[model samples]
Target: MGRKTEQTMRTYHRYLGFFLAGIMAMYAISGIVLIFRNTDYLKKDVQVEKKLEPQLTVANLGKAIHKKNLKVEKEEGGLIYFETGTYNTITGEAQYLEKRLPLILDKMTKIHKANSDHPLFFLNIFFGLSLLFFVVSAFWMFRPNTPIFKKGLYFTLGGVLLTLILLFV
Candidate 1:
């Protein structure tokens, strides 16, 4: 690469690293938290009360409250008892205990899981491109003939190999 290109890459890489440090940390922390999603790690149950449409059936109640596997255990005097809590058919009140992470952690996880349909998808794409830029810019940090550059290549190969092994084995 030309000296000018190398210099530009190095400058941009350093600045971008600084700019993206907070987001990168968020991704790292959220990724680690997501690995424990199946477990109840860092989750707390809190009682939640919501006002839904009145006189909803058991099937409609589940859809209204955004609970998928909601089963009505029993009914007594227009009130229905489910797994987490109870709902009154006569009134538009639904009381439930939901287990969730703290607000900030939950938001981080949501951002981590953002899909094409989500507003955060644009941020995800930008972050992905920034990471790709970092990977490419790294090559321009040092000349290919240098010992440090050669060692970096070896480390890169090791990372690729480790990723493949984890993926397939």
Candidate 2:
């Protein structure tokens, strides 16, 4: 390869790596957190209690649970739960705990969970392509005949084989 082309490839790989490092770290952390999604590790619990004076209609019961004013979407059981509502029913005192994620990371986490139509989805796809570039660029980082390059090739092949086996099996 010519000196200028090789140098340009190196610069492209280097700058892309630098640009993506922080976002990569964010993905790694959030991905780990998502793997344990059902757990309470990242959520803070807030206990809420409300008093009711009404004679406990299903709609009223649901409103109490939701702690907001909401239209009764559907009613099941003798109790009522609206999409969002606040109500007072004669059940001694109704209380529940609300789980809330931390503010800033929560926004990032939402973006991470976004679907294809979401604005962040394009950014996510770009990030994934950047990762693919990082992996491919790694090969050009070294000359083909170099020992390091050969070892890296073997490792990459092994990784691909392992993934294929896992997928098929």
Candidate 3:
């Protein structure tokens, strides 16, 4: 590539690296948190004690948990639990583990999980393609014969090999 092209690639790589730094951090943290999904360590425990109205039906449990109108078909023991909503009844409290990501990170994560109905689906696709372009452009940022480029090539090969092994092995 010409000097100007190389410089332009380097400039793009540097700025994109900076723009993605915070997002990278969020993904790292959320990824780690997601790895321990089977545990409650990352979740905050909420305790609630309230006197439910007498003559309550098993069907009315969802309302007792502040999620009224929830379809609850049965009541077990002193508690009524909704099949798909919040639960708060009896001495035993319902555990709600929630994590609120920062606005930008949250939006990015939502875009990643976007469906066709999501308004930012097109933008998400564009950003993803731009990232792929950046990855391909990285090679031209350095001279083909440079040691760093050679080392990077070797590392890239090793990473691919490892991924393939993990996928099939």
Candidate 4:
């Protein structure tokens, strides 16, 4: 509650906010793009052909093609059929239609959705903790008894309420 402590908190908050601005913008843009991922918006379809080891089973074919939740609609003779394309068991050939975002956009989305396997997972943890620090540092910007801080508390509560509403709906 001392004057020097408040000043230090504000300084850290200000600089950290500036330092994270670029990454924050990237996440915002990536989030918006991901909302349209199910659709072909800003995406291009390409005919992809792959040649793997022959005689792969349906599960193995899915693994070879790097597809998840692959459904084998129908299998006839040597060909395995799926929603996007076909695989030949005897030939170890795969031909499929693949929808892809532009290279930079694709990288952005991948960074946004970093998993534990990715090197960026540690960066994600740091970024998440930094964001939490920003939230806590905001309270230190003003003393609790001030009118402005009281008003900020109301605004914060409103934001929390809105988030809860969005979560259920």
Candidate 4: regions farther than 4 A off: 69-77
User: For model 3, what is the alpha-carbon lDDT of residue 88?
Assistant: 43
TM agreement with the true structure for every prediction? 0.87, 0.67, 0.59, 0.87
lDDT of 2: 0.71
- Model 3 per-residue lDDT tens digits across residues 1-169: 8889998888888898788776566556666655665565445544444455555554564445554456654566755555543344555455332334455545545555677798767865766676787878889878988999999999889988999999999
Better of 2 and 3 by TM-score: 2
lDDT of 4 by residue, 5-97 (tens): 899999999999999999999999999999998899999988899998888878888788888788999989989899999988888889999
Model 4: lDDT of residue 169 = 92
- List candidate 1 segments past 4 Å from native: 55-59
lDDT ranking of the models: 1, 4, 2, 3
Which residue runs does candidate 3 get wrong by more than 4 Å?
A: 47-127
C-alpha lDDT score of every prediction, in listed order:
0.94, 0.71, 0.64, 0.92
Least well predicted 10-residue stretch by lDDT in candidate 3: 92-101
